[model samples]
Target: MPNATTVTEVGQFLKNPPEGFTVEAFGSEYRVHCSEENLVFIDNFRSGDCDIVFQNSLGRKLKMHNLWEYTRMRKSLLSKRIYVLVSLCDQNIPESSKKEPSEPKVLQKYVLSIDGGNPRIKWQMERGLDWTISSVAGESYRVEIDLSEILESLAAAGVIAENLMKCNPIWKDSSFSLKYYSDALFDFPHWFGFSKRSFKLRLIKNT
Candidate 1:
């Protein structure tokens, strides 16, 4: 029978990622990267397992053609050291979803890699950013990222949001997770701030 892993064990491994690495693990989940110096920690509260988490101040670039182009610029500026953390839940995918399921004891995880559906790969390669991947797995896997390169890519894309601009924030608690989302859909303009630009909008009453 296949072995089962817990979040606590995963946390232990990430507590110390390595010299050029930073790690975090807890609740049967963890993330590690020696070259990128990045780690992720997650605890599953649901009935099933949680996948990886890709944590970064810069979220997805709004207008990129693909993930590759986005990754290229990100690696170039972040000194070729990038950290991407992802977390997953065991939600049901309907039969119409066109995705496959893992067997009873297996799970599939796709990290923030060039081929992992990065929307900008081709454009990035044309821009001259060189990147290679290395994968390691034990109780878990260690994926490498070049931070400098990633930062640079964000700047070039002009999609890096100011609020999440920090390279990495000081997380106060030993076991905590960060999540991002918008209350409204893409087309609906929600009230995020009351800045000058937003205040100029006109309000009208219908008859």
Candidate 2:
């Protein structure tokens, strides 16, 4: 089992992302590379397993080709221990998402995940989250995201963007994990603003 590794300090990451790097997101560690730095958009949210990223943000990026490109590159990447994140979308949403779609198709923003479909791998995250919540339920931490919902949204986004500039798709994938790679950092879009992934989420008070 992999240890609970995360680069909380963005500066440290940007400064250095050793070789075998992995970012924790999508209830698991998503892939990242120092070379793809500028290409990846970074951001954070109150609720998500992405050390310090929003679950939704990661979810949306699941619809992009850059992500798949990463998939195609998986073998060349961490070929030693690989678990590619692949999504077999059902293009037909069956019915328009009752979820009122996402923010908007900026023809830009949309972008973001499942790690390995393995249930055990999921528990790894659950345990980590459990410990996080128990240790700091009142303090701070990221939360699990509804992947099912995001995928539904992506299937509706139409095909993905092969050419980055071709269509922009939704937006961009928010960089979240890794450390054993080289020199990368936790960054966010200045335009969108950043929030602590540990910030306590405003839970709905049960009436």
Candidate 3:
């Protein structure tokens, strides 16, 4: 049996997740750190999936078959929330994409956060990290997320576009995501977003 655990250390959680563990969604680069619970999904990525075209990583591509196995494996634990705590890595102004009007070149790369325009960049980082706590239970045939964690820019332009279509507060908030275009955007974050986003889907069809 795979050891079911509640891991704290990222290293322990991921068996040597390669540096630059980044993904793209909404035409932006997002670094994702996933802490899994009763889900052995990552290990299933055998360093790469050649069959999955247009994928960035060498790990095997995840398919509906994998979801079936994940569901089957967790049926006994439906009483417990089988979930993951996924954290997106932050980027500083310098590390941010240059496709936009990147300013303050005086500062060293990564010297400031991507939200260099925000007066409260430091404070915002503490309280405004883009994170999602996704959990699924037997009662609901879908994933559930905390609404407060919705990233407006990401949801509108890329992932979860429909749910956040009405969001407008982002325009006023200087701390809103830069939402720049980048070549790094790929399958990873899109999958991560859906895996965590609250949505309904039929995993099985009734005969």
Q: Using TM-score, give the best candidate's number.
A: 1
Q: Give the TM-score of candidate 1.
A: 0.24
**When superposed on Cα atoms, how far off is each prediction in RMSD?**
20.5, 20.2, 18.3
TM-score of each: 0.24, 0.21, 0.23
Give the C-alpha lDDT of model 3: 0.26
Q: Model 2: per-residue lDDT, tens digit, 1-207? A: 432111122323423444434444345444344233112323443222434342222232222123333334332222222211222322223246645654332232232222222243344434433443342211222332223333334434443433533432322222232211111133232123321222111111120
Where is model 1 more than 4 Å wrong at Cα? 1-20, 28-48, 62-79, 82-107, 112-207
List per-prediction Cα lDDT, in the order shown: 0.29, 0.30, 0.26
Report clashes for each candidate as comma-separated counts.
Answer: 52, 31, 10
State the lDDT at 62 in candidate 3. 27
* Model 3: CA > 4 A from native: 1-7, 12-37, 43-62, 65-87, 100-197, 200-207
lDDT per residue for candidate 1 within 79-128, as digits (tens), equals 33222332222333346653676322212121222221122433343232
lDDT of 1 at 84: 37
